[model samples]
Target: MGNCIICGQDVDGRICQSHEEDVVFDFRGDSPDQLVRNRFYRGVVDGYADFGVFIDLSPNVTGLLHRSEIDGRLESLDWEAGDTVYVQVKSVRENGNVDLTSSIRQSEGEFRGTLIQERTEEKLPEEVEEGNGSERSDEGNGRERGTAESDGGGGAVETGVTTEAETETEEEPEPEPVETVSEPETAAPTAEPESEAESEPEPEAEAGAEPAAETETAAEPEPREATHSEIADLPDRVDELVRIEGEVVSARQTGGPTVFELRDETGVADCAAFVEAGVRAYPEIEIGDIVRLDGEVELRHDEIQVETEALVELEGDEAAEVERRLADAMTDRARPDELTLVAHDERLEAISGNLLDAAESIRRAVLESRPIVVRHGATADGYVAGVALERAILPLVREEHATSDAEYHYVNRRPLEDAVYGMNDATNDVTKMLQDRERHDEKLPLVVLAGTASTVESEDGLEMLGIYGADRIIVDAAPADPEIAAVTDVLVNPESDDALSTGALASSLATTLNSGVGDEIAHLPAVSYWEDTPQSYLDAARDAGFDEEHVTELREAVALEAYYQSYSEKRELIGDLLFGESEEAVAAAGAPEDVAAEESLAGHIATQFREKLDTEVETAQANTEESEAAGVSVAVLDTDSYTHKYDFPPTSLLLDELHRRSDAEVTIGIAMDKLWIRAETDLDLRAVALDAAENAPNAGISAAGLRECRIEFLSGAREEVEIAVIGAVTEQFD
Candidate 1:
């Protein structure tokens, strides 16, 4: 026998049985039937189609990598028609068609095994020598063990590595074997898998077992009804019987237990259900299904886990009752623990229900395995809000999924300039979702508009999703148009309360969405505001241990990072700056290095923020054309001429700082195609546009914002249009 190239185990062929799928092969087989299913193969890029990429595996064999199989934005792929890529052979159609899937590992270095040389009839030199020896041996017994015959599901192949296969991997008992619970008196479910009880000795009956007094199990009367228990409170109730009804967010059959991730409104916990060795318990159970379960709390590996006894799917009215209770509990429990000094404030309370609704949609997306795409403005407030949701949702994702890359797969934050979700962004989402649907069979993601898309300018972009029938949620701290709120599936706007920053609203929402990450993001709301923060919010920040200095550093640091990558959300940097003080994260020697790293990074970025803002504001203020129009102070700047329009510290951020620095009640920035607005008081641009159209028939202007003062006007009417628009906007203050 020869040793397997991987793991150095004795094998009949080049690779071990388990690692057969790890190596990508250069397929020479002409017929589809000759190819092995579930094997990785090296293929050449043949061409691309709108639906998928065509790959040439061999002279007569080809496969398709559907666009849906890609992991990122398909448009960004730098692949050409002739490059090589690795793919997994999924299946071959009866009519000679081949289907392929994206390999999790793309490079040869990523694989842990070696390549096998496929040859026709003739065996390797070593095989020929062994055959000759067998024929010549006079005293040898002619006993033969044959290789595995296909059962058609990538069934076992003989690698001649019998040591581990016979002793461990193939015969090893599942981590925890299923057993029939011999509880004194309990009714059994209709179906149960085979049990290990008959073959194995019970843990309690094993030699060197603890004495009777050491056993935690006591013959006590069971409660008439199962006591409802919170997952977090399971530790205190160890050795006690309890029941929890929640959605089965995840389930996996292991050697020892069928672990189910049960999530209720309160929190998530794992419930281990076992029936027999290597047997799947509750064969009909699946993820995303609701179940009512009874289990005794147990401490395994210093973590709270449930020792499941009875598990049944809650159906009909029973299911409806459980879901209704869960929603009520979530609405109450998901709310931020304290609204800061602002929690009891009259204004925020007015729109609290809307916040809860938006939070519910986001949380539901997590439970349903739907992707969440957060589109936020590339400002400190937008980044803070976007990161707030990211912080809250990521932990839930890690808990719910077995895949290591689930966070990246299920949640994405895209930054938009102008704080608007434009058609360009909509097109990107549409292409991505369609591809995901085709490739991975993922459902269309729930697009959440936060910190942006609360105005008329974003309406067209948001409505674009209707072509695919995708739903959206909007949570804005800006003065939003009421119409935008009405159109969204879920909307939480500060206008219903009072003018608040999106960061503040998102922080509160984050607490309700996942309080587990709330403390890490508590300082975000205060960081969102440049100045004039509410007393209640400041008090909340203070309570969360954020001083004014730290808040300022975070605010400036986020602004700096946001400016650097205006289009891409700085997820990692923002998370570190905002949540560096996490107690859960520890480094070597336990120095709380994450906290230290965050402070250093924030301080450095804040320095850059102050210096950059100072320079940009100076340029904008110097170039500003301050004039009086119809008894209103109007500051008009030729933004295209005066500002670095295409670099970091985007035009919106520069204009915002300029408007704040200059004493301009109404500021109008004229560019080639669009007009930018910033004002001390809310101006009715819709009225101004109508007035301009009435006075100058050729002006051709349209209004498009709530708090933002942008409008669409003819580029040819630049000088004349600005004069008319400024005059019309100035008259509004009257």
Candidate 2:
């Protein structure tokens, strides 16, 4: 006997037959024909389209509640994105399009009924003769068969989804029984059973007819409760029937099957369940529902995924047990084995918890097969850190998936100019993710911000992602800001510490995400520094066999390549320069020339790096001007006249070099609209910008992104703004 998930009644099936009619099952089956027409179902709003609201009935089944069927305008329905709604399946077309009618009533509190009948599509109304004892059983097949001709016709293929029933199944399988606590979706249309009950009489049967007799058949095999399988074990169990249980993270309907992302204690897997042609099946399952699944493991298109056969919702004690099990396992390996610190400092120690959370979020992204997009500043440190993460995650992706090209599809490193995640970048991400969902039925990606997320300039972009439920993680050396920290899902920033560079923070976080690549990432911190290498970071590199000269070559090489496109991560080029990767011998034969060529690339780039930075510095110093305010002296450069505006060496990198050579207390590089500064002191440039704006009212000055060695002012008011900025900045020192 099994216990019903809703009422705890012991029964012969997953749910009791008595309460079957009272509940709506989460359909794990494949077809739209399986859904009962005129049946109200509980659903979550997946998103809005101009024509209707797309409501997710089950993880794999979504139905449209059209504006024509709704009581109010679609915009005034009081529904936000992802809100739960109740709607009725008015009809199911042969091509699997489900036309839904809206319900004013929502929630189970409004419904009244005892469900004695579970899902049995073959069973229909039987007419009974009023004066005779005989009855005949004959009912409509329930499917409104024919081609769907309208806007809803093409929606079946929205996500490249082919009907699983028509293509994969050889024959229509017997319909299964379903039961769950029925939650009414609207106020009265679906909730009022008394009116319908009083208006229509019981179904009648013709005289001289008999009910269909039950056929004698072979006894069915008894089903035993299945034990769960870990997703990590799936690669070894290909073609084998296995049982696994987990919470559904996401669900998307494909042309063939409804894919549910099932995540358990160990890992995550995509389990595809099928029902019928174009028709939604099992209208009750939802994302975040704890369920047990039985399926065969398969490799589809070189990627590991599961083909589901049977599924059961686990609630009450079962759900709590599964959750506790997962939590316990998470506590064990959610963080790194230990910290790979650049230096043993109190600031790093204090933020260790945040670091662990950030690392765990990246690791979880890989486990769930979601793409990881790493955005970082395009500088020596930024490239090194981004490369280190790529190195760590690529190997794991290859290990977890059967596809050789999974790295390209599952992981990406995007370089952001000036380490600022901007609105343009966020819009691009949203468009790509939405297209991927509509074209391939994949989940939204996880975004990891390394060296770029701490700046408030990224908040608008982050909020855009949050609208679609994309996860954002931040790992940076920049001091924490409360506003940015609050926006991030997991924030890893060394509070009040500016000593660590983006490279150091990235390498450390990368190691925490995947420790097997620690050796490859250990030398990264040293390669990020153009000069003044911290002793501990330098020692870590020396121990890895990189001396000062070689480290300098690496820093220069990466900087030159990083500056060229500034937007192109050039992952392979950067990875080759930093780690010297050579292709392994092919199945037949290969040459040593390939390996030799790989090692020479970095040195060649380094030579070019020196030539470029040297020329830019010479030009900058020749056009330099000096000024004094209070006791502080400043060296200012007209970047338009000196530095290359659209070439190698970004304004920030150029200013850093000029500052190193200057005897002045501060160095400012001025361009058309903004100014970049480098200072020997750690005063807040944001404060100075505010003061300058007040002193020179027409300048319109503000801190450009982070409250750092940077500020922006109106280009039209440059002369007056410069004077006020110098005065305001100097007063802070006094």
**RMSD in angstroms, all models?**
13.6, 17.2
The C-alpha TM-scores of every prediction are 0.61, 0.63
The ten-residue window of minimal lDDT in model 2 covers 135-144
Per-residue accuracy of model 1 over 457-565 as CA lDDT, tens digit each: 7888878886687779887877777678655798877645355888888877777777676566666778889888877777777888888888899888888788775
Which structure among the candidates has the greatest TM-score?
2
Off by over 4 Å in 2: 1-229, 250-260, 270-286, 298-305, 311-320, 342-347, 365-371, 395-410, 422-446, 455-471, 496-498, 583-598, 627-633, 706-708
As a TM-score, model 2 comes out at 0.63
Give the poorly placed runs of model 1, Cα more than 4 Å off.
1-344, 466-469, 495-497, 581-595, 663-665
Error of 1 at 604 (Å): 1.7
